[model samples]
Target: MPKARRKPEALDGQHFEVVVVGAGMAGLASALRLAMFGKSVLLLEKHYVVGGLNSFFARGGRKFDVGLHAVTNFPPKGSGKASPLIRLCRQLRIPFEELALSPQSFSRIAFPDVDLKFDNEFGFFISEVERLFPREQDRFQKLLRTMEAFDAYSPEVAGDVSARSILGEHLQEPLLIEILLCPTCYYGSAVENDIDFASFVMLFDAIFRQGLARPLDGIRRFLNPILKRYEELGGKRRMNLGVKHFVTKNDIVERIELDNGEIIFADHVISTCGVVETERMLSSASQDENADDVSRISILESIAVFKKQPADFGWEETIVFYNDADVFRYERPDELTDPRSGVICIPNNYRYPNGEQMAEGQLRVTCLANYEKWVALDENSYRSQKEICRKAMLEVALGYLPNGNSMAKELEERTELLDIFSPRTIKKFTGHLDGALYGSPRKSRNGSTRFGNLYLAGADQGYVGIVGAMLGGVAVANNRILRGD
Candidate 1:
């Protein structure tokens, strides 16, 4: 068993080499990396628990993960140093085997006309594309080569370049393009209707190329190890304490005021809260230019727990990205949610060791949601709308499953519990303005700000997914903080 996390010493009037805000993946990783380098780092979080959007919650004695559908960027064992997961483990000094990851059986992209199934193998996806859209097979290959060469992490790269425009240049079939965009955009894109080409390349590499996997026990299994390792390295952390403001002097953060009104100081501050949220903490007035960049895109998710496993009812795929409409619309709806296109995730489908399985079946349906519409509702209306939208989302999602229409009545009957989370839940918990799922459309690629010592990480740092967020945090710490940039 791991040692208990030691409580941090008093923070008021204390100084550190670096202060990391928000205990999300990025912030945790940043503080851990800095600590490993023998720097005095203070990690602060407003929430009592860590993990931020990737965190978990307990209800009725059962735990549920928040943002994890699957941990993207899963490479097979012995995949070598080039793998991002491998590199991250090496940097953080954690053993790869400690995560106890389980690979997916297979997942599918379901549309009104066609269904494409893919697993960890890139060739399988290629074969599916060839079998489904034979005319664009060669064009798709060319597109893959283009994505392979694109330097998505370069600070000088243009992040706002439209991915749809690039896809148009490479492929002629609009359906195929939309089909590919369905999963990628849902997984990471902040921009409505389309994802930027830079993010497209990164997410394409993460989801399709590197593949997806989950820890045997969900996110806490993954997070606890990192947190344990951070504590072992003598990293200091304070829960339920948040940065209220950044007192700046001539474009450099001189001090930080906590939500409790206590003050602390650091030479450099790294924020994983988000671009707009971070900017708002500044004492200066010039940081308001990027306010409009706050993302409008958010999601509403419905989690249903059933009496039996998903496979027992013939729902075997690990994840299903589905679209009821001919043209997939990846944007916030005028109403609360757009159930026409969404994702269905079955957590019970992973191949755990020794045939171990979850005691109960679980299904999660996610759909694009309008933040403003959901936030404007009163408590009574919000509760009523949740129930109404929960049924609607599940109803549409069930149609895409194999023999799903036939099993709907039985599945509904077998459902033991149901929980729903909206854009309002995201905003209230993660402190993301507008409850944006992927943060601002305009990214701070270099993690730079007008304040010289303040840098951004996580969503607004232009990386997506859990692995990407950790990489973003490590990069900023290495490039800017460690290298003295």
Candidate 2:
């Protein structure tokens, strides 16, 4: 059983072996892994709930996932033991079956002139690419061979190398390049309009090679078991509490100041906060040195719940990455949102076991948005603009669907609830500057900082998705804290 929640006063003078900031996937995994080895760990989260970017909320008696479209890096059962998902489960000592993962039925990359569909099978995706861009078949295969040989996890290798430049070297078709980049950038890129080659390789393997899946009961179902296992193993976590600052001495984080002004100490500290966010938390005078590295990328997401399944309206795919123009633009929009290119996800499209399905249809659309524009709005205007953008995004997204024009009316009429979140909402909840979804453009591949005992994890640690984040956390704990590398 877990210990009772410790109040701020009770933990004021407490000392721990390791202090993990942010109870997201990385923090939870790190704390749990350390505790399993009989190390004292303290996990802190500012929000009332866990899961960080992949968290959920209850609205109108219905649960809504915030950042998760689908859990990437999903390999089949008894296969991919060396895969990130399997490795994460193995490291955390969590049974793979406990995840209750359901593979996506299919997902597509839809452009103005072409559509390419793929599922769990890598061969199917390969065939789709060949059929859509037949001339580039050999080039695509050669590119894959190159990616397969690249060591993406090497800490010594520079991660900021341009993936576009590399893609151009392998493939001649601009459309094929754009189509491939569409899903990869939307899924994990922090760099505007392009992704680092290392990240590109990682995401390509995770999304296209390994594929996407989701827990049938939402993120909570996957997180609850991890939290339980951590608690059962004598790990401690405090929710609705956060670290205000890290007091450093001689290149070491010696003390931690809680949000309530309580002071604590830890032999080692692992921060899952984004690079810029974590840098800002340092009490030292040079805290803002890396402020310029803050990411400009943010997103506008809207969710609509309706009475009928999306398949009823001929929308059978689990997710659709769409672009209206030939050249897919992924940069931060000057306006509140750029709905021309976005992602549309139907959660009900997943193939659940025993023919199970969601009680209602849920459609989520995500678009690139300007954080500054959204944050500058007044309260009333913010609310009003959300509604405005919600309608606009849905209108643009509908065009990509089959029989889109006819289904729009029925969708609006059947929609029982509608909610939209802007970059402002993201900052308020996740504390990420400018609501950057994937964190800083510069990644810390080794999870190191200037301080000897301090380290970084999660997004800024050069990992993406839930499983990747957990694996990153485990790596930090095993390599830095426990192994003392």
Candidate 3:
């Protein structure tokens, strides 16, 4: 998977059929697609490694996946179907089996009154809901029918519809609505309280129909192959480089200026950076005066490595969506955490290759946090604040355990290491302005820009999560670049 780096001098007058900014999933997918279509592509990144927010990092000889807990849109093997993941693999001519995905046993969405453990299968999820709320069976069935009808996220269907409104139309119980929206919305939502219907449907199809799964060898195993395929397809990638500005002429982008002042011309430019960053990169001549500024939310994530799995302490769920009440509000809170809602992920629960289990377990706890607050603190104060928040979150997390009173004792006794990542850390590493998890809360764009030759993918295109982001990249490439629609 080694790639040749371009010397600064060699990049002066370099030209490519396509210039893609960012080496995240979306960018990688776009570059790969362009390469497969026999176009010369140059993929650029500001980071030393790929994967963007959905990648991994290593510390103390143990590797931990940064953003990906598990992927929702996993199409079963040999289904002979055309899913987003499947289509990309076939288009790239990479075998689907190379991903090595395994369906999770189950995950829990815990409420004060009820605890629902959902398997990957939709029938199982529906049946569990029906069993608990017997009278809501018909309602649940109607929801399934509606979701099936709206599965294909057409522009007309996805037009600015609020997810809260959509759920309200089907169910009356507040608890039921919260239960349905909790996992997917928290995973990736740009809006304050309501996500777009398209995002909702995308999450529904990915979680309910396709089911969730984890790569046997972690996220790297899944992405590395795609990256390797990108390289093999004749796509060129440049690491530790970023776009500084776009040179435009007559409403079309003709060239890109790098951070090092190197200029590269391109037939087309595809950007995976968010909308705000994209707008900033445009010169005054090409900048859109009416460009919308999106509202973004940041997060506080803590990683705790345990000497043993939580299963030993009667905590067997792979993921737990816990809240004090049955209300899930996904917004950037003034405080570090709401304590009412957050997610706990146990990566070690995944079925490893050849039935192998890890020697130790890793747990990740994530909640909404204010980026502005973190940015205001000095380095010393920031570290102190992170520790304070981590302690508070751990206390809240203990309540979700089987034996709440004794759980902390068990966890502390077996705790191997603890690491906390603040919003500032996220911004520093990923180059997101405010450490926004999924970019701004803007309406879905068709991946087109003011300039005819420039386009967008990833968060800027309004697709969130691993599958949605990658598919957004492919959609833009196929429709705009390849099909020329």
> Local distance difference test, per candidate?
0.87, 0.88, 0.77
Off by over 4 Å in 2: 1-13, 286-288
Evaluated with lDDT, which candidate comes out highest?
Answer: 2
Name the candidate, 1 or 3, with the larger lDDT value: 1
lDDT of 1 at 39: 82
TM-score of each: 0.96, 0.96, 0.92
- Residue-wise C-alpha lDDT for candidate 2, range 276-365, written one tens digit per residue: 888888996565677778888899999999999899999999999999989989899989999899999988988999999999999999
> What CA root-mean-square deviation does each model show from the true structure?
4.4, 3.7, 4.2
Candidate 1: worst-modelled 10 consecutive residues by lDDT: 1-10
Give a tens-digit lDDT track for model 3, residues 56-75: 78877878777888887778
Q: Could you tell me the TM-score of candidate 1?
A: 0.96
